[model samples]
Target: MSTSKGSSSRTGSQIPAIGGLDLLKAEINSKHTDCLKLIATNTEGNPSVVRSYISELDNSSFILTWESANPSLNGQIVFDFKKPLSTKAEILNHISGLADSAITDLKSDTKNSVRLEASKQRYCRYRLFNVPGSAVTWFMFAFAYYAKTSTNPISPVSAVLSVASREFFAELFKYAFYFRIFEGIVVFFICLYISSAFPKEISESDVIKWAFSSVLTGIFSSGAIIKLARNLVVSKAKSKKIL
Candidate 1:
């Protein structure tokens, strides 16, 4: 494709704009990552209470406490920070949510089951529908001390990866249970609905087809419902905002 001089000039002009957008995105992501790392690590990148819960400092990964749950503890950040906005309150609110989660964990029974430091009596055994069984249940329980959560300063990705490695494999055998009864029940029901949608009476081929279809439907439907619920909560919170 050949570009006319006018087209080439316009294209050149747009490069700076593109570069600026990229830079802005990098800045925001870097900030979020810092927040997450701080929430996960102490000054030494070694949390004293690493075995107590899951802390998400990034989109894809999380720090599992001895009592952790959801893989993305950073979900609130994902939705709130996705688009452009300039409100100090919003950022503070997000951090407040993180702080709230830490305090709430102490009062609640959830995340304890996954704790590496859990007692034998409280060891929880459950399944996440589509996720690999080892990845979901076993890995979480076995690796409770691999990450930590707190209000410490954040660090670079290289530092985070280093901490994860050092803390990764101390498990010859350790486990426990952290029960979030209400949230756990909701999760169970969602899984049950998806599972029941695919009848076992069907042949292997049919069952596979039904399972895949059901999973897709379940994910989209449940996600939409959750999104609506979150928006409602956010709206109510914003309504109460003085600004």
Candidate 2:
């Protein structure tokens, strides 16, 4: 399969108003400490301090984000309403309170305390999981899963080929190639098992005959089928990219 690079252009907006908005909503419902330092880029004025959350008013339909770029602007007051404040002032007050509460909690917790250390560990592990680093790690994980399984241990090469075909072919053609390879492997093992199971009756001649037939009729047939399917895939991918 061919990979293509697409071009991207940057705009005037520093941080998008909705960047990482989904994560913010999730943090509100879950009891977790998520401290994110975002560097804002804008055309004018100081960068805004945005606090995102999914309160009651929006029904979580639209992402609710609060910003504190200018404290001296106006309406620097506290909030009293609790049923998911909708008005700008109410939401800003709620964010301020939330920030103050978070700060208070941080101060109460000792810097080198067990709770703080454990939290740091947990966050670091979670960060590692969330990072988009390498496909090798995921491939290794899949290999491990297959190795430990008792039945249907997936062949990594076959799995890779199957996925590549799937990306190119329709459902019917994809599955046909997948099953053909599967069948070829199964027939080989079955033949070996049968000959071994009947040690005295199954002779060298029978074993040779079975092996020869399996490759000629089974594995060879599968290879030809896959080759044709792969050619078709290449044609389609080329056409799509051209258009």
Candidate 3:
């Protein structure tokens, strides 16, 4: 009886065993190669471990050694064949299938983990402050109003006159100021949500500062846009009356 021993230097407690000496010899002989080697990973655990081999032919049995320190998470079968080179294709196919399945499963698990994290983030945002949805709705309504009024156009001269008029300013102040307050609140909540999403923890003072800055920006933006829109509407109406 002849025997061969293989050894690998890697970190871990577990290692894979060798088997199917008969089949491996036949394949190596048929291929007329000095030796054959194969490598794969075991994917059943939290961190998958690699399994690799260097093989040498003995008279009746082939020996396999593990290149890595840990054994596979799950035990795998060692292919054995009685007939020389008869099952070579089958054995290769089986190994290929195992490798493909392991890779596919790993990719699927990673994708699921990402999706789960995203869901958690969305839920937290909703629970903490549901401002994005409200902001989106408000913007949609404003867009619709603008779209409806845009059909009736006004000249540049009329637009300037409308902005200068006291009546226009009064209406602008009445609606724009209130809308600015709403916009400021929306901005404050948005800033809070964003700050919470960061990995680093923020202090109450920092949050207040963020809110103040964001609200100020929102007020300026909303006030200017609303003022322009109201002025355009007034200009269009005044021009129509004159015509």
In order, candidate lDDTs are 0.33, 0.36, 0.41
lDDT of 1: 0.33
Q: Give me the overall lDDT of model 3.
A: 0.41
Per-residue lDDT tens digits for candidate 2, residues 1-243, read 111111212222222223223333353334322321111111112245443223322311222223454544211111223353222233334444444454454443312222232233211011112133224323433443333232453476457545654334333443554554565467556646744542222334444554454344435544544555566568668989999
In order of appearance, the predictions have TM-scores of 0.18, 0.24, 0.25
lDDT of 2: 0.36
Residue ranges of candidate 1 with Cα displaced over 4 Å: 1-201
Maximum-TM-score candidate: 3
Off by over 4 Å in 2: 1-196
Compose the digit string of candidate 1's lDDT tens values, residues 1-243. Answer: 111111011111112222323333343344444333334332123333232222222221122232114333312211223332222233334443553454354343333211211121221223235355324434543233233222342454346546643223222112111222233445545545533442211223334444454444345434433443445456557767956
Error of 1 at 33 (Å): 73
Q: Which model scores highest in lDDT?
A: 3
Tell me, what's the RMSD of every candidate? 30.7, 24.5, 19.8
List candidate 3 stretches off by more than 4 Å: 1-111, 119-166, 186-210, 218-243
Lowest summed-lDDT stretch of 10 residues in model 3? 1-10
